[model samples]
Target: MSHKKALEAFYHKLRNLRGNTRFVGGSLILFSGDFRQTLLVIPRSTPTDELNPYLNSSVLWRHLHKLTLKTNMRVQQQRDASAGNFAKQLMDIGNEWIQIDESSNVSPCHQTSVRSLKA
Candidate 1:
C-alpha cells in the first residue's frame, strides 16, 4: 500500500482501538525514520508546510510531545543506570591498573623514563 494509505489505515485502527478501550489518557508512539525526510514523500498531495507533522502546533506533534513526556521519565532512569555502570567500569579498570603498577618491579630510573615518555 502507498505511504499515505498506510498512514490513514494506521490512524483508523488507532482510533478504533482507542474508541473501544475508552482510553483517553494514553499516548501513541509512532516512528518514521528521519520523519522530516520521509514526510516529503509520504504525503505527496499535501504541501510541505501542512504535511510536516513535527511542528510544535501540529496535532501529531502535540500527541508526540505528550508521549515523549511519559517516556522521558523512563529515559532518565536508563541514563542514570548507564552512567552508574560506566563509573563502576572505570573504577574497576583503574583499580586493576593500580594493582599492576604496585606489583611491577621497576626501578626509579625506569619509572622516571616511562613518565617522561608519557609526557
Candidate 2:
C-alpha cells in the first residue's frame, strides 16, 4: 500500500476509537510514521484533507516531535517466485516499494527479480 493510504488507514482507526476516548481537558494522540506522512495526523479543530500534508514537508516537520528507524533492512535472493520469494523481497523494502517497482511481472505482493538498494 502507498504510505498515504496507510496513513488514512491509521486515521480511520483513530476515528473508530473516538467514542472510547474521554477528554477531560486535553487529548492524548500518538502518531508514528515517515516524517512526511506523520504530519498529516496532527489533530486540529479544522481538519485537513488526506493529501495535503504529504505534499508539504514543512507542515510535516513543524508538527513532528521525533524521528526514528533510519536504517534499511537488506537481503539477497536467488531467482524464485514462491511465497518465500515474496517474503524475502518484503523484508527488504516492505510492501510499499513493491507497489513502486516498474517491472510488469513483479508486483508489490509478488515479485520475480533481484532488487538491490545501496546502504
Candidate 3:
C-alpha cells in the first residue's frame, strides 16, 4: 500500500494544476484496497510506525465515503461447500468476528487456504 503522504502530495499537485483545491482537483478519485490485507511496508518498524502512514491515518480519510463489500466471490462463483466454509472463516478472521486469545494466537477451526495465501 502507498503512503498517505504520497496521496496527499498528489492531491496538492492536482490542486495546483486544476486550480481546484476542493478534493482531488474537484474530480472524484477512487481509492480501493482491502485494509484487512497487507498495509504500509515500513522496514524494521513497529506496528505503530506502519499504521501511521496508512491512508486511514490521514486527515483526508474522514472526508472519503467508506463502503464495505459483503460478498465473497469464491463462495458465490464456485458453489462448493468447502470453498464457502473456507471463505466464511477467512472473512470472519478479517472482520475480527472470531475472537483470539490474549496470547495473540488463533486456532484453526477448519482447513483453509490462509496459510497458502501467505506463501
The residue-by-residue lDDT of candidate 2 on 49-75, one tens digit each, is: 545445232332343356556334332
Each prediction's number of clashing residue pairs? 0, 0, 0
Candidate 2 residue spans exceeding 4 A from truth = 20-62, 68-119
Q: How accurate is candidate 3 locally (lDDT)?
A: 0.83
lDDT by residue for model 3 (28-110), tens: 88778877767667799999997898788998888889888888875799889999889889889877799767887787889
Candidate 1 Cα errors over 4 Å, as ranges: 1-8, 18-30, 38-58, 66-119
TM-score of each: 0.26, 0.22, 0.74
lDDT of each: 0.48, 0.46, 0.83
Estimate candidate 1's alpha-carbon lDDT, on a 0 to 1 scale: 0.48
* Best by the TM-score measure: 3
